[model samples]
Target: MSFNESVLGKEYLKYCNLKEIALNTKTLDLSNISWFFPTCLLPLGIFIKEHKEIHVIPPIDIEVAKYFNIIMKDKIDSVKRSYIPIVEILPNKKLIEKNLDSLISNKDYNMGSLNAFAYFIGELITNIYEHSKFSTAYIIAQRYNQKNFTEIGIIDNGISIPGSYEIKGFNFSDIKALEEAIQGLSTKYNDNEYSERGYGLRTSLNLLTEGFEAKCLIVSRGVGLIANKNNRFFYKMKEKDIFNGTLISTRFDNNIREVNVYAYIDT
Candidate 1:
């Protein structure tokens, strides 16, 4: 009925079933999927990108359609400026700047620690283009006015953590690989200077969830690693039919204390 319920409730199974079918065939049917979480965007985009001839059916529900289009389509104007969409996964700061601009323009947000929020989002997105094989990616955001929380969702189409490790002469299950990644083990190393590549995911998770007491979710392949302040857990999902990229959802409460986002990535 509502957005969250439609996404996390029964429609989830429908989305999964559609995704499973799309894996074998070239058609992605979204007729049953009235909505989705940020976790779904990565696999959805990858499916479209991977199978060039794939047919995607937009949701029949008008409200859901609008939200879906806002995320999937790249349009910026007076009416739609509240959100910015990036269709290509490139190492471009301009995209990040656009996101920052959107956040500022949407006065509904309190924009606590704007600089830190900017860096937090920028670093995560940048990592996608730099590593992840850069196949395709998507970014979406939503503001919960009453709740005073802004959620940003980002995902990429590439070799997931487990797949990356497998390629590097090491094999680990999806859960194990996700744990390794969150623990700050990056398969990538910066070409110049000290290794600044690995800490982005871990640092952001710690700052946003631990420091600000926000909720976070990281989906890589078949598992979702979630953190809420001091507690961290996971959900096994999608199995072999999972997204090849990483998907992250960061929730920020407008009333939270300021954070020095840069200080978290000292490693």
Candidate 2:
């Protein structure tokens, strides 16, 4: 199957289709996909790695092929799993912090921006544990000195944003759920203290766009959002494929500095 942004969905069907293809075939071809999203790209990498026999045919799109090569470079040359282990359950916050610290330390970039990026990563991952019903989550990160940017991808196969809110008794469409999420609204009713709910996505976006002048792309269900320092916009997928959960990809400029990580996380 040719994977593209249009085939991205929030139901189990899309994932199932990929899994079926992987299981039945020794070599999975991706040459047909001209354009792609990290939401699908990251999880597809994880899925392929899990199934050792499956070989991926490079995408026809040169840029897409380059991205896959960069993110999975360690895997491309070796059979060993070099990337961080997939977290099947909520990981300990301290462990995550330690990992982030190590990840940041390896980068020769602005300390303040790195710190903010670390915080943003922590929050985004934490959201998966707090909000989703899924058991597994995948993260992939790469720093491109030539491109002068650092990219991080987090993905999960679970109940989507709208599905989670619906379970909490709020009826809304996928786009509405995404809109509310970016606005810092939560399905959890907290009359006395707003802090008790709904700060993950908004605060993470603030740190990325406002704090570091970064760019973020979030895809869930049938809606996708892209935000940067100057503006934020949303687009609907053409096929209405349910994605079962969420995928967030962020890119932070290596040149950014003077970020107030504490303030963003606290507020």
Best by TM-score: 1
Off by over 4 Å in 1: 1-14, 21-37, 52-54, 74-88, 91-112, 189-194, 235-241
* Per-residue lDDT of candidate 1, residues 115-144 (tens digit): 666677777776776567754666666555
**Whole-model lDDT values for every prediction:** 0.62, 0.64
- Candidate 2 matches the true fold with a TM-score of 0.70
Model 2 segments more than 4 A misplaced: 1-27, 30-40, 46-101, 191-194, 263-266
Give the 10-residue window scoring lowest on summed lDDT in candidate 1. 1-10
Worst 10 residues of 2 by lDDT: 75-84
How much RMSD separates candidate 1 from the native structure?
4.7
